[model samples]
Target: MNTQTLKKPDINILKGQTITGKWHKKKYYVVKELGSGAIGTVYLCVYQNVQVALKMSKQSHSITSEVNVLKAFKKVQGHSLGPSLIDVDDYISANGHVYSFYVMEYISGDDLPNFINRNGQEWLFTLLIGFAKDLQTLHDEGYVFGDLKTDNLIVSRKPARLRWVDVGGTTLQGRAIKEYTEFYDRAYWQMGSRKADPGYDLFALAMVILRIYYPNGFSRGDNPRKTLQQKVQLAIRSQSLKQLVGKMLNGDIDKADQVKDYLLQYVMKQNQQTQLRQKRLSQKNQQETSFHPTLEVVSILSISGLCYIYMTLFL
Candidate 1:
């Protein structure tokens, strides 16, 4: 065998290494790699005895843009729509190359598909409503989530919360979208441009709904738009929701507020119907239980009287 030395990994933070915040000087221990994409890799870490997610980018420019977008989101932190930014810093790799990274709130939850699997699909209406409201908040803040998708969304239980991750695609309104998944992109549907608009995000949201409703058929190697339209028409019987989905596909994403309101109404109506159903069921059960004992007593008394009279007559 030829004598050669193994080289260390380049520009990437390895697991178990300690990363210190440049400003606060707080140290975080890397647990494991959460994910890796074109721009960067995310790691689960422990900071101040609390778990947090840290994103390290290969290119300094990419991390810089993402950090700025996250900073903007911080200005409107009251909404709690996206993960809270913790800190930003630079790390020197084994090869002496400087890499940029940022820390953010670690969301402990399942993605959309897994969440539906665990919670049942009945909660979809409420989940979508919450997501739409978050998007509305981002829109109100003059930003658009360019890369909205199932993977980027995390849903929590108990209270049923929704949160967005991956700020690299965030863009200011009226500019071209910085990034997007092809299936969720309006340009792929031949419906609109790649401009960063509220409608663009809405179109992606529509795709998200379609994916949730028809997990297997949404991307079955056919014309996605046509297939989606046909499936929605055949499967979804609710006229109001169908109309909302149609508007989203048609690039009318500015109507997110309307969709949100409609979903809210639907959820409220469902709750009322559920309560009514439960009440009726309880009453029916109560009535049956009350009637059966009286009937049993009357039958026993009649049988006893008949038996006594028959014995007297025979004797």
Candidate 2:
């Protein structure tokens, strides 16, 4: 049998199967497939009774660099941008072929766009600021998240936060971006090179915001660049920080702090409005409660007087 046929069997990881680490011998129970991409397949798994995400790739070499990148990210103390790398190992199948896999914290949440739709768009300002800060952290560490897109982001509540899931596109500074979605790629817009820099990520970040703002309208036509530019102009009218977003799309905004500051201001303004509205509602409710008893007492007395009159007249 050829290599393609040999690797084919390992790709279909059945549910409930156990994948054991080659070196440490730790075993993880496969729960279900989470997602699949060009490089590998990810599965939800339980390791030592704790939920984790396991990524398996047929070509082990393809993910070796990503593993190193993740290790570097893990060293950044208090980094909440993405899930912590748990373990790395290779699993030997029954046929004795080695398949490489790595485990990371399982993020339980909806994707960025879905979460916004479900939770309400009022949270977008906070979410975007948090996301920009995360990118800032990564950039500060001398790395670029080449493929920054909504699908790669997860937003959770109970302490609403955002986390990056797929780290395959992460690359060190000065290197060309390894991977990117067409719409999110700066090169696709002919605005800049694909070099892994802060500008590249910032440009993609701006695209992400525009996408969330106009999900259906931003389409890829024959003239994709012109189409995107038009969409950006329209988005500016509908979205806050129009000039900032325009600058970002043009590869002008590189500092994440700039975006964060603008978005933070918007979030604070929205929060104040919400609080004021809530306070007014509370006062209205209080007034209605205070007036309710007097009306009830007057109504009871009127009914009693009517009953007495009826008794005197009819009895």
Candidate 3:
């Protein structure tokens, strides 16, 4: 007899189900569905009384690929850009269908757009700097974040740094980008190809910058390049920021480290200019103060001399 097709588990039914790893023998209590992606569905679950994120999918190959990516993240030096891979195992559902699943660190934070809106635009540069560094690490390790959008990013509190999530779209350098959103895709804009490279990610980063300015996102008109440039001019008043983003979009700045360096240099130049202006103003104020006191003294002396002359001539 042919086996019955296994349908995607309903959220309501999965909420209270216990997922026991067939090999690891660890159990996780499903709290709720965090998100559903093309590859699989991620759930917020409690493992050994601690909250974590677990992704399960019938496609075992895709699940294994994502698990390898997570492992690669751990091998990268410095910061861990992606979530830490906790456990990898198989779970059998009530229907006796085996599903591949992996548990990862539960990153609790606000999405990029909401975080920036609530905290104000002051956080944009800092977040961008941190994000560039993280991206640099990934690129150095031979990976490109194909789907570079705000939706796949999270801002954690305390130190308030940017963190990447939903890394399923990450692809190795030189290969075709596995997945991408059109708004952020250079190919969609007719600016470049779909081949995975630093430029591809940088172009997406530029779109992400625009996404902040146009929260609802703009449409690609008759000319995508012209449309993007017009929007950049309209939204970004800062010449430096506009130039940086423009370079990224145009593929002029292709590397993540270059982005970081450019931002840091701009920030440094701005600080120097501000300090120079402050110094000049301070000097001008000091000169005015000295002139006022000297003028007062001269006035007093002139009046006393006139009074002495009057006394000498009349009395």
Candidate 4:
């Protein structure tokens, strides 16, 4: 095969291509394309028995922007709420297109956005609680998801999974952002004009939760709730993302500490219960194996008598 025969891909090769459904890598067969974005395209791929979602850059250097961010997330402190990147690969396509690919656990289920679209306001708080639990755990581990957008967040039912997809090219190490920027307007994004801080991250999450609660005036006015149905509707739509967030940062909603306290209490009670159960089981096992002299002697004598009776009858 003459490698030179392939046409060089520039603006023309990928011109009509949808970001979501092209195969640059064949080591794993791409089942189908799922979604697309400005930076990369996502494909549902299969590797043996495992089903995974793989993403590759449409642009050469931009892929590194996301890859670098994902690498940082890997170092994040606690239980990351999303799928860990299993592999990152780079190769040339048939059109002489150079690409870098990222493989991640294809989270099975609908996203939180879709859920919000289908469900009611009642689910938002419950979902946010789980999300906060997972996110704070990640921050405590000294890492941020970079961009905390709803598109980057995947949700499941019963057992909630905030599948953290990687950085949306949003990376700041606790001291980079300074003041307001256009990007910081989103409920989960912070535009720091001075420096990046974990506090900003909390503010972002609060913004996201509040948007779920109040969509209309999350930025300036009230969330536009005239009726119960409208109020419920507001709870589901993801709005002005930027303005709602700005409003939230300026507002007086305090959720971080409260959720933290609740988590501590819940974790402690669970540990105590686990320990008590283990201790009781250990005691029971010890008693079962314990040597009781009276019972042991009776058991020996009964066995000897039975053996003698059998021998005498045989004789």
Question: Residue 297 deviation, candidate 3, in Å?
Answer: 26
Error of 4 at 161 (Å): 2.9
What TM-score would every model get versus the actual structure? 0.84, 0.86, 0.83, 0.56
- Would you give me the overall lDDT of model 2? 0.84
> Model 4: per-residue lDDT, tens digit, 1-315?
544223434322232232232454336666777777766677788766688877776565566666666666667645554666777777565655666677777877666656765785445555655766766665555554445555556675457655556455354556443223222343323223334445555555644455445433333224322232243344534443333333335443333444555545555675698999999999998887675666898899999999999999998
**Residue runs of model 1 more than 4 Å from their true location after superposition:** 1-10, 21-24, 216-224, 234-239, 275-280, 295-315
lDDT of 1 by residue, 202-262 (tens): 9888888777776753552457567667877976667767888888887664756877997
Can you write out model 2's per-residue Cα lDDT over 263-285, one digit (the tens) per residue? Answer: 88877787898999999999999
Task: Decide which is better by lDDT, 2 or 4.
Answer: 2
> How high is the lDDT of residue 290 in model 1?
99
For model 1 the local lDDT of residue 249 reads 86
Ranking under lDDT, best-scoring first?
3, 2, 1, 4
Predicted structure with the largest lDDT when compared to the true one: 3
Give the clashing residue pairs of candidate 1, or none.
none
Q: Give the range of the ten consecutive residues with the poorest summed lDDT in model 3.
A: 4-13
